[model samples]
Target chain A: MLNCKQTTKLLSEKQDRPLSFRERVALRLHLIMCSGCTNYDRQMGFIRKACRRIGGDDAK
Target chain B: MNSERDGNTSKAAELWLQEAEIATLRRDMLRFAKLQLRDVATAEDAVQEALSAAYATRGRFAGRAQVKTWIFSILRNKIIDQIRSQTRHPTRSLTQDDGRNAEVGALFDDGGYWHKAARPADWGDPEAALGSEQFWVIFEICLNAMAENTARIFTMREFLGLETAEICTELGISENNCWVILHRARSRLRLCLEENWIKRG
Candidate 1:
């Protein structure tokens, strides 16, 4: 089980690069059991959504 | 491309902005400039200079819809000019000396768990928050509150849309350290936004 700290760092890194299959599996497994990290992930998504609006890159 | 430009020229020739529209656009450009230059007077000067340049070339612009983006790119160059002129030494390290380590450290505990007070709250209807001017005001405040170098790197990544590698090369920092800075910035920004904007709502 990845702890909150490791899981959060991975969440940020995944934005910059593709994660290995093992890393992705580990993250998915950890996320399934952790509400806190799950919320953190969702909040990160919200931030990116906000970024898209500011940059006007939301054509999709 | 030349033929395309010719077609655009014919279609776009009649799409010039009115004086009133330029006046309104100045406010948005000023807000963007103020964020980068961090000085209202200097920001105004940059925007003024860019607008003057824009007016000189306004006849050659593509179309009404793209004028906003076109003007922003011009303003971006002017802001960069201001940044270069004002800073005697612009580069800084991400791993040390920015003083964010202690702040980010405080968010986590000895065992790598979120500090009780640092746990995130649910930001309900954040899309609605986006429509609020106050939300952007809070965001600007949050961004300006970050360390200078951290904010610059973040702006480079988010506002300017520079890739991490390009940023690393330009800043002369390691890829690993660049990621660290970005992570630190994001963590602090999210926490600040959550506390001041979302939680209050």
Candidate 2:
């Protein structure tokens, strides 16, 4: 049972690399029960997309 | 006939150069460099240097990539050089552990769970937000507000699309430390956006 802080950290790491099976299972189990971590994960993805659009024309 | 073909080839090359010049938007490059370097004058110098380099190497451009992409690659190299030089100086220490500690402390409680007030809120229509010009203005503000090294690491990974291993090599930090920095950066940025932009709406 990964707590929200550890779960959010793992979510950020998942953006950079693939998680191992155990880590994946833990995050999934935690996310299923925790809306805060789930929202954090979604917002992190949103921020990454927004960042990619920072300087240039977004149409491309 | 051969002379006519040679003339056409030269014309094509000339047109490509003109298109490249038109496609390189100075303001956009400056914005990106400022975000990465966090210094207005240095960002201007970097953009200037990158443009000159692109102009000098225009003859070698194979025209496979878009002109903007070509210019961006040159700018990236220039920014990386600036980062390397800045890091080599002894006046600026690489280990700024205090900011990182405070950031972590603010986010997590004694039991290592998210502090009650630090929990994330739902950000509505993030795709739409990305398209909005005002959202980006706020985004840049939040990004610029972050600590220098942390912002650099975040932009290097997200904006520049560098792998973690590549970032570690370029920044000369341990892999674990790199992850820690990235985690903190994301957490801070997320909270900033939620409080300043999403929640306000």
Model 1, stretches more than 4 Å misplaced? A56-60, B1-14, B80-92, B97-100
- Worst lDDT run of 10 residues, candidate 2 chain A, spans A51-60
Q: Give the per-residue lDDT of model 1 (tens digit) for B110-170.
A: 8787787777676766778777789989988988998888777777777666778977766
Give the per-residue lDDT digits (tens) of candidate 1, residues A1-60: 677788888888777778999999999998898777787888877877776555434342
User: Clash number for every model?
Assistant: 0, 0
Q: Specify the CAPRI tier of model 1.
A: medium
Point out the worst 10-residue segment of candidate 2 chain B by lDDT.
B89-98
Best by DockQ: 2
Model no. 1, DockQ: 0.55
Chain B alone, TM-score of each model?
0.82, 0.77
Give lDDT per model, in order: 0.76, 0.78
Compute the interface RMSD for each candidate structure.
2.0, 1.9
In model 2, residue pairs whose N, Cα or C atoms come closer than 3 Å (at least 3 residues apart or on different chains), thus clashing, are: none
Model 2 CAPRI rating: medium
